[model samples]
Target: MTMSFSPQVLLSKVARERCIANIKELPKFALNDEGSKKTYASVLVPLCVVKEEVCLLYTLRSSNLKNHSGQVSFPGGKIDEGETEIDAVLRETHEEIGFNARDVEIWEKMPIIQGRNKEMIIHPIVGVLNNMNVDNLVRSVDEVEDIFTVPMKELCNIENHGHLKLQREKIILPVYTFGKYTIWGITGMITHLFLQCFLPESLYTNDFMRKKYTIGELMPSKI
Candidate 1:
């Protein structure tokens, strides 16, 4: 597929800006009457590599896992003892996805996003892969069931995604669903917020404003 920006260039811009509004927006989730009162620190990366265009990589957690099992998510995990959030995020990416820390060029970081329970703080890191090929990639079988990628254009285009409310006080965020998976939750919210903050405001044209999504379209694999 044709691409509008060089993966390196776009990531460079995002890294330099390090937009954090979404992270700041986390308190909104906390204040809402959702579930818990605990707070934990975690880091995740929107890992992208340039193919014909930039592609965001994701993983399906093994169904037997404890938290968020079988869900589509970015490569990441909880922060380790004495580790900074960025260091933790980079470290987790390598551990979970087998992405060489050196191969990724960080574009920017979104703000810390809080969990529904207000017990977890999630730092979103955006970066570009230094190389492209399966050989350079890795996945932990215990944590990841499968790894796959989707085009960057599909993500940046607002028309292909939408939001659904889970309850009066809760809403299921929008995400780019490809084939059998739907990118949702904090990852989906981060993706949605990224387009609003980092991409040029002009891309917010009518076409970008009108798209809506459905569960069938978002999770083709579920059916």
Candidate 2:
């Protein structure tokens, strides 16, 4: 089915309200540890017009990076001292891809996603970009190997989704593979959460749900 959502639609009042309302209904995870100190970070789920269609931007991390090297991820990083989550997301996006903060319109703040190490808390901030062209992105070669976009229609396709079985607790993860890039782990989790804002409730069953905990419960808490 063809989805009619566009960068403009994502910024519409109706869409924003629906997204926020859905987020409230969804379950939010928190860290399981009682005393483990947590490192906070933030990422921008950037939506922009690509080829006259709405698409989400993703980055290929440089292979030389120490963490999650050479992996596909959103433009983001660790929150700086005394900085808010929104500030961190904007700063990281600029530092990674040279995307100006003035061109972005913040829309939604997704639930916090905890890293596998159980000590890092990531805040996913959703936003729409203005006057963005993939070809014009000034990628930071030191941190980003490349930048790409996936249309909303392709992202919503059921055919593009899959699952990976875990070794512990029989946990399963929802995976999305686009071309040669495999989006899994925390990135996959964030993608799945964002999809919830647009996809029908029924589409999130069986392979998409990951486990009995529902898609939202797949990630543990960070609070």
What does candidate 2 score on TM? Answer: 0.85
lDDT of 1 by residue, 74-172 (tens): 887887778876788788888887877777776656666777555777777766666757566788988988888877566766555656445655565
State the displacement of the C-alpha of residue 204, model 1, in Å, after optimal TM-score superposition.
5.8
lDDT of each: 0.64, 0.77
lDDT top scorer? 2
Q: Which residues of candidate 1, in runs, are more than 4 Å off?
A: 1-3, 12-39, 157-159, 170-172, 204-223
TM-score of 1: 0.76
- Please report, as a residue range, the 10-residue window in candidate 1 with the lowest summed lDDT: 200-209
Candidate 2 on 128-215: residue-level lDDT in tens? 8789977778999899988989877777666667776666747676777677676777888788888787545644332554323243
TM-scores, all candidates, are 0.76, 0.85
